[model samples]
Target: MTDRELFDTYRRDVYYLCHYMLHNAADAEDICQEVFLKAFQTDRQGVERIKPWLLRIAVNMCKSHLDRRKRGVLKELKHFLLERRRDTEAADEALERKENELETERWLRALPVKNRTVMTLRYIHELSLQEIAETLDIPPGTVKSRLNRGLRQMRRDLGKSNPNLKGAECLE
Candidate 1:
C-alpha cells in the first residue's frame, strides 16, 4: 500500500497505541507522524503483517521517547500528585472520573516498559496473546508472564492505595 493509504488505515491504531503508551496526546501525535515517516522510508518487501510491524515500530519509538523524557515524565507525575480537587457536587463527579483515569494512568506508568506495553496491547488494544507476542517480538509465554506480573503489581498497588477497591480480583 502507498504511504497515504497506510497512514489512513493505521493512523487511529498508531495514535491510540502512542497515546496510551505515553499518556500524552501531543507526544502521541508527534510519534504517530514519526512512525509513518519511518514506515515510509523502510522497505516492506518481507513484512508478513503490516499492523504488527507498524505497532512494533511504535512500541520501540515510545520506549525510546519515554527513556529520553524520564525527567519530564517524573515532573508530570509530581504535577499530578500536587493537583487539587474541586468541591462542588458537579465538580465532585467530574473529579471522581478524572481521579479514576489518573489512578489507572499512574498504575500503568508504574509498570516496567515491557510489562506496560504488553498490558496496553493486550487490554487497551485487545490484541491476542500471540498478537502481542508478535508485536513485541517476544514469545507468547513471555507475554502471558508479563501480563500476570503486571496485573499482580497493579493489584498490589491499588490495594495499598485503596483497600476497598473492587474488581482487582478480575485481573486474575
Candidate 2:
C-alpha cells in the first residue's frame, strides 16, 4: 500500500493505541506521527501483516516514552494515593462515578501497564492472541499469561471491594 493509504487506513488505530498507552492525547499524536514516519521510511515489502507491524512500532515507542518519563517508580504510590482519595468520596459521588463508567473500562484502568496493554489489544481492539503477540512482540504464551494474571489481579484487587464489578468474565 502507498504511505498515504496505509496512514489513512490505520491512523485512528495507531492513535488510539498510543493514547491508551500514554493517557495523553498530545503525546499520543506525536507518537502516532513518529510511528507512521518510521513505518514509511522502512522497507515493508516483506511484512505479512502491516497493522501488527505498525502496532509493534507504536508499542515500542510508547514504552520508550514511558521509560523516559520515569513514572514507573511512582506508579505504586500514585495508585495507592488515587485509591485512598477515591475511597474518601461521598456515596453520591461514587454512585455518579459508577453510573458514568462502563464496567470493563473501569476495571481496565485499574490494571498495570503490561496487563492493560495486553487486555486492550485483545479485547478493545479485537486482536487475536497471535496478533497481540505480534503487535507487542512477545510470545503468544506470554500474552496468554498476562491476560490470565491480569484477570486474577483485577479480581483480587477490586473484586472484594466492589462485588458488583462484573465485566471480567471474558478475559480468559
Model 1: colliding residue pairs: none
- The parts of candidate 2 lying over 4 Å away from their true place are 73-101, 155-172
Can you write out model 2's per-residue Cα lDDT over 10-119, one digit (the tens) per residue? 99888888877777879889999999999999999999989888999998898899899975521211011124457789989876666544455667677877887887
Give the C-alpha lDDT of model 1: 0.79
lDDT of 1 by residue, 1-172 (tens): 9888899998988987887667788998999999999999999888888888899899889879988987234211212322345444476687776777688878988988678778777776668898899988889999999999999898989888877667745343
Model 1 vs. true fold: TM: 0.68
Residue pairs with colliding backbones in model 2 are none
Worst 10 residues of 1 by lDDT: 74-83
User: How many Å off is the CA of 123 in candidate 2?
Assistant: 0.5
